[model samples]
Target: MKLLLTAISGLLMGLTTAPFSASYLAWIALIPLWLFTISHKTTSLTPGVKNKLKIRNIIVNEKTLIAFIWGFAYHGFSLFWITGIHPMTWMGVPWLFSLLIAIFCWLFITIWGAILVTLWSVIFRLFIGSKEIGNSPLPPLTKGGEEQGMGIKKKTWLNNNLFQSISRVVFGVAVWCLLELLWNQGDLWWTSLSYTQSPNNLTILQLTKLSGYSTVTAAIVAINGIFAESIFVLGVNKKQFSLLILTGTLGIILLHLGGFYLYKQPLINDLSKEINVGIIQGNIPNTIKLYASGWRKAIEGYTNGYEKLSNQKVDLIITPETALPFDVEYIIKNSSFYSAILKQKVPVILGAFGSEKRSYTNSLFMMTETGNILSRFDKVKLVPLGEYIPFEDILGKIINRLSPLDSRLIAGTSDQIFETPFGQAITGICYESAFSEHFRRQANAGGQFILTASNNAHYSEIMPAQHHAQDVIRAIETDRWMARATNTGYSAIVNPKGDTLWISEMNTYQLHQGTIYPRNSQTLYVKWGDWLTIILTILSGILWIIDN
Candidate 1:
């Protein structure tokens, strides 16, 4: 029964976090789960029926054990989306090997949960001490709150927990800030660094400059979470807790909606009609995409999508990054149909592969209705293993033979915004969306909207999508509307304030259309970048020192 209750509660909690009206209520529901341990106590049986009482105690113990089981089960289910990619990744492997990998993932997740609980235990203890502003009542270790019942140093234990929680939060924030500082270096954008191998490789590390602001942003988020924890522990009444959680979540969600709403209302001036945008999803296998033949299938899938949208009246069409498979310059310059589609006068923005004989770049191209190239935006950041391996030459000889993946896809040298008739659009390909500074630079540089082209088919839709939703915080960071087009799921629109206006189902091919406001402008995140995170980290550090 306890297990059942825990499972049901967990499922409810997960469902409430979905993109729905009830999501704001998850914090309220979470409290009961946390509070359960507070009241957990064993009961003594009557002397008249000692044996019967033993049976009753056994039942209670069973119930308690089941409850713990249910809690873990619920946690696993709530996080099942994290595991979705394992099955997909294991498709071509031998059955036994795939099974082992799948089991390993589940095992890792279970261990992760154990670690999270241990961390929460420490943090929860800290929250208790600071909850009511000073020394307060805590659960007695034994019956009747008797001093002789448990003689261990209670204050010492409590203080230790508080110290550990504060230390973890402080350390986590500091590490994040340092990483951000390292990535951005001196310039907010367009900072260059020398490479070990290619002195003339002249690599342009703009994503960290443009999008590397996440380190600071994440620190600010941690501060807010800490504040929320304080409120949960110290707030006067249940109503206060409910209202605070509700208000905070609602305010953030509204903030997201308001940005897009405000942008569209003013820029369009009531004249903007809803535009149909077709997104193409090519479910290409990650393992095969590195090989020579990978490009052909990817191109074939995109060409079919292009032809399907050709006869339609789409004002704009989008394709995931590198959806073009083979080099775009080769096909667009040589292929007849590629030129013919653009002649129809509908502008298209599609992910393509491009090279200048000396170097290759993962890029997005903008074409006029007549299929002529108007502009191009190369991906600023490269995926670590999927795109190219770092320190390849030394490691490549060993890794190349062991793993049949490519190690030579190179990075780009610029953060150029695409000039579209609607306005200037900035591209954050894949992981670029996680970095706030990159989007800030784009907005500061007169970008109208953020268009993120991603290929999430490699991972399951849950984590990637949830990870993608974290970008709403980025939209909140920059106050610029964003539209994400992903291959194999989660193509959606986000308002400038950070609300997901609409999103598609995972692992399915679909086209979604929506109205977005585009304007050359800036927001708090654009101007200040990661000052909030720095400030919060400093504050947390100061408090930790004082508390210790």
Candidate 2:
């Protein structure tokens, strides 16, 4: 029964994120898990046997297992679209083997992501010690010096101290954000708690300018903790229960009010300039892109989109990742694609392969109107197993069969900016958008706008929408306009306010033109990346020490 409740809680939490977009569910998603922890901690044991057995350690292990189950369910449901990579016959794998590989990848990543939540639960149980002091019965006083009820004297350890209650909420929220921060620095990161409110909870998302998405994440976790506390105190302490309800209510009201004020503030200044940008979505399939026989079709799809957008005389044209599907030297020497780009009057920012010595890189290139190479930014965060295999020395023989790429691409330096004709811009190739700090550094380095190029053709429909939501969060965090161009669908233009001004359909060849402004101002998040998270982590440690 406890495991069932934990799984349900995890599923509800997953629904709060994109493709599901049930943001309201986040407020109560943690209640069941908290209740389980409370009940497990307060369970009665044989009076004499409790001390003989290692009950504390046993209960801690049980709580950790429950938390792991919850996390597994949450990530598995949220990232179910990972199985869309199956049917690798397009890349020359057997049907059964391709299906098995896709399933294995899904389970491996789900378990990897679940580790953070498991650690969070363990630390929370250790520090918070879910004893529910408010609900415990108070001993009766007698005329004698000692109390009569339990043979203990009256002491100051009263029920439902406001300070203790507030500390628990704060510590829980801090631990959650700190774990998210640490996990994001690693190789795999998909959805953060902040994304649960994205594109829908616009007012709440505006707070991200103060600190990164951790602000929103804190808000979510804090509210859930308050409600969980209220549930635990119901019918036990009326004053504390009422106070908890009022605190949760007032917190929500004030958060939205403050967020609205921030959202209404002007983002553009007199020096802000607008550039007419054209985004191209070439719906090229993986089968055609990998084989030599279909290179012409791939070339035609992108080149035709380029010519069409250039005819509109936009200031700049952008293409999806690997739009050319060939290295720079090969294109310049053997293909007409380079000549086609040279003939265009407008400058083009296109995605293609870059070669350095014998190493290849997935890179974005900015070209001058006269067809000269202006600047290049290689992809920094490569997708695990998709872009390159990890632990190749140990697992290379077996895992290399799962990758679709012919060769591994090298990672570029972090925080690199591209100097464009309009202004300096930052680029996050496909998977890089998931890391907020990656873009925060470039924004701090004087990047006025963002350009993210992606190829979403490999996954199902759900992945593109989730990818789009991540870009929305990035735009709000850095206070910059974003131009997202993708190979299959959901290419969009997002403003600093997290609004999707324009979007395209999936599996379609489309051309979209929108005006994006380049601003000189920076948000607090851009200036001090993850500073709030660091402070919260320190505070949490201090609180743990004090509580212990």
User: How would you encode candidate 2's per-residue C-alpha lDDT over 1-548 as one tens digit per residue?
Assistant: 88888998899989988878998898778777666654424444445655435346634567778888888888888898998888788888889888887898899889987787787776676556634434454455566644543353323334334555666777888888998998899989987888888778889999999999899989888888887877766776677789899999898889999999988987664344678899999888877776775578778877787788888888899999998888877877777667777787679887999986677899999988887788999999988877777887865676654545456788998857799999899789999988999989889988989999999787988899889989999999998999999999889999999989999999998999998988777888888787887888788778656655
Clashing pairs in 2: none
Candidate 2: which stretches are off by over 4 Å?
Answer: 38-60, 130-134, 139-160, 269-272, 401-405
Best by lDDT: 2
* TM-scores for candidates 1 onward, in order: 0.58, 0.93
Instruction: Report, for every candidate in turn, its global Cα lDDT versus the true structure.
Output: 0.53, 0.82
lDDT of 1 by residue, 1-548 (tens): 54466566655544533232144333343333333322222233446756555554544444344434434554455455544434333335565554454554455454444333334333333322222322133445767667654555565544643454344445444543444455544211110110100111111111112223343234233443433434544533343345445655664455435433543443222236344566666667665665556666766666666667756776677888776655786777765448557556668787877774566777888887777788888776664433654457864553342223222456665567787667788678876664555667777888877778887776654555544554555555565667778777678787654456787777675666666667545555576665644775576667656665
Q: After superposition, how far is residue 509 of candidate 1 from its true place, in Å?
A: 3.6
